[model samples]
Target: MRPSLGRFGYPKSVRGYAVQAPGAPTLDVFSRRTKWLQKERAARDAETSRKVDYVRDEVAARLCERLLDIKRHFPHVLDLGANACNIARILTRPNPDSYSAAPVYEPLSSRVSALTAAESSRSLLHRDEDLPFNNEIAITRHLLASDETLPFAPHTFDAVLSSCSLHWVNDLPSVLTQVNNILKPDAPFMAAMLGGDSLFELRTSLQLAEMERRGGIGIHMSPLADVRDVGGLLQRAGFRLLTVDVDDIVVDYPDSFALMADLQAMGESNALAGRDVPPIRRDVLVAADAIYRALHGNDDGTLPATFRLIYMIGWKEAPQQAKPLERGSGMVSIKDVLEGQRTGGKSGNR
Candidate 1:
């Protein structure tokens, strides 16, 4: 007989692993920002915020391309992150009325329509906690919510999209499960999040410098999920027709300090609970800066920072989607195929 799985089908030993453990306090490295409206502060930070939005715009555009390729119109869409409602703006542009369900009354030049548009951080919104839109594009609901806890009915949306978010989520699997539950069967769910390799140059430089200056390294960066883990995460969350891809974006900065400044403006600075209680030592920071320049410097005297984005596209599971074949259902043997290849068949041509 086969060995049975532990709770949640995770191995018993793995139950203690931070990534696999459900509701692990240690894994909650990111907490809701307690600062005074960080999003507003970021907006005022000038070019740094624009640089972060450049990445977000790329993610939003890629997601919109996929959505458009699906061809079928989505009557109801959900924007999970909705930071400045970028995704909705992309979808509704070209012609907002092309997507609107209503007949001509007055041109809805100031609004667009959506089933739900939610922002995890309320501070990201403008005066009324909403985007400035034409009357043509009206959002039915503007929710101040997080991915970890989506307050919506099950099978509620025709399509769902998230951009430049989900990397901050601590319990990724649980949030994915919640995302799955709210999506209608066969509906599309698309997201882009930073992958494990993001800021590797910075992380390595800091670690090496810290170990040399101090005795050991501290938790300077939050742990991010790898591209390899995403496919399984989608399947585990009851999503099929799964597709995952990686996009590596590298940006150059004047120095490590410049890079750190941009990260702060992006609101993506380290937030690990177990990070060093004391402030980082000046010597360690100085050493790290030197190391980063020495290793990653460019001809322009700048340094490159890599942002690895993992894009995921999945559909809520339904009977219509393709299924894997059952065991022993193959019509041809692998051994026979190999023999044919050796005997001057198809495989010999290459």
Candidate 2:
């Protein structure tokens, strides 16, 4: 299907999106964005550092345990779309063992360039290949949500780890195909992506102001891809024993402008798919900030912004499906399926 202008009058999918074969043009677009994301990486790290301390002190640390298990299976690993190379630096530290474990980050070319601005001080390496290493674990965070196509074959990876990245992607099924192809049979492809309930306050406020200001027409709000959808996606992708857990983090902002600044710092401001330029506003942005604050402001003069993050853990290194479900054997109950969701399970308490 041809790409169309979406609700905000911005172009939706680009021409020839969704990579159908190896060495396709879709690969070019994904590689090209690295230069831009690199510039913003520094700013984004700083913003998240300032406002998201709780996530750092608690929620984010649990990822280390997950990566440790993947490390045990495959000592060498690769991280794609490594913004600021933040995740790698956290996990690959303080290890003085003979295991010689290291994880590579394939950030977008733009982000790679930005890391260059720092010279040898960069965590992400500058490389975009079909596969970084042979017979190894390849993990990507939030890289799948943007592209309609991928540069991988089926069942190619030993293990895969994706965290907080897939919501930005467009074609769910096709992306899943690429993901499944690279993962070895019964090999767990554990990942965390944005769910349908993320950024509720920001999305609602921005939408209301846009409609009010423009007479029922406004720019499109970036859609939060669903976590529950991942279950079906995994089933169709032929993944088994899939487990998905949802978690929420409420990030409070001093005001709406502070939130907007952080998002801009993260290069997440644009909802337009074909946009190759940073969105420029020629008019007074302060007024728009004012309108946003007015609509989303709080009683204590603080805005409550909620971001939902889902954590998924599945094993891919296994070589076969357990077995097929007999027709109408009765769907599994929620309690039976979520048997592992106890203390220190995928779901952790506050």
Candidate 3:
């Protein structure tokens, strides 16, 4: 049975863990409350919030493009970790410019019969409800739920899509399992998250500054999943035909301070567990700014911050799905095929 939500919208079991016996082992890596607060604060400022949404919008469009490639219609889709309805907006809005270039492209809304946008922050979810697309036929429901604990029955959704979220989850493997569980058999799960190399410039600058100023360093940036391990995580979660790839989006800022401000507005600030350390001293921040410019400043008097987005596609297994042939079943020999090609000669007849 699923645990009921306790105060602050977390499962009762999660709150219980907070008071567990001392010295007990735990798997939690992020403070859910902190993340929720960050997102809520970001939503409160409408103008600044929209500014940082460009990244999410770009990623959402790319994810929707991948869905268009598959020739299947999703009767019901779940937008897990839906932040301000990025995926929903992309799916519902028609891009006449792109349609003119490629008439073969079909609108994502036509393919998606219905959508449920689920987000952890109530403020953000409420903000999503205010979007004009909610009146469209695509978005059918808005759910307030955490990615850590998905409240849904098995085989509920025909497909699942997430954009610019999931990296903040404390237990990613568990969440992926829930995603696979809710997806109907043979349904595809498409998502994109920040990879380990994301924001390396900021991370490095902060580390060096802290070390020089305080004689030590602290975790100023949240750790992210490495692309190398994403496929394994998907397979472990029972997702089949896994596809994983990475893309880097570099945005130039006037300096590190401006970049940090954007990150805060984007609700991408650090929310690591036990992150109670004092904020970076002003002197340290100044030193870090200098170091950042010296190390990675562009020739145009700006700094380049790279966000590496890791894209993953996996499918729920079904009996009808195609499977790889047995290893020794191949009749053709690669050695002979290569030799024939090298000689530019015919085989049996010649």
For lDDT, the strongest prediction is 3
TM-scores for candidates 1 onward, in order: 0.76, 0.59, 0.86
lDDT of each: 0.73, 0.50, 0.86
Instruction: State the local distance difference test value for candidate 3.
Output: 0.86
Worst 10 residues of 2 by lDDT: 112-121
How high is the lDDT of residue 96 in model 2? 18
Candidate 3: worst-modelled 10 consecutive residues by lDDT: 15-24
Question: Judged by TM-score relative to the true structure, which candidate is superior, 2 or 3?
Answer: 3
Steric clashes per prediction: 16, 32, 0
| lDDT of each residue in 45-119, candidate 1, tens digit only | 545665667667666766665664565656678888676666655555553334356554232212323546777
Q: Write the candidate numbers in order of decreasing lDDT.
A: 3, 1, 2
Look at candidate 2 and tell me the lDDT of residue 65. Answer: 49
**Candidate 2: misplaced stretches above 4 Å?**
1-60, 67-72, 93-156, 274-299, 317-350
Question: In model 2, what is the error at residue 143, expressed in angstroms?
Answer: 12
Question: Top model by TM-score, which number?
Answer: 3
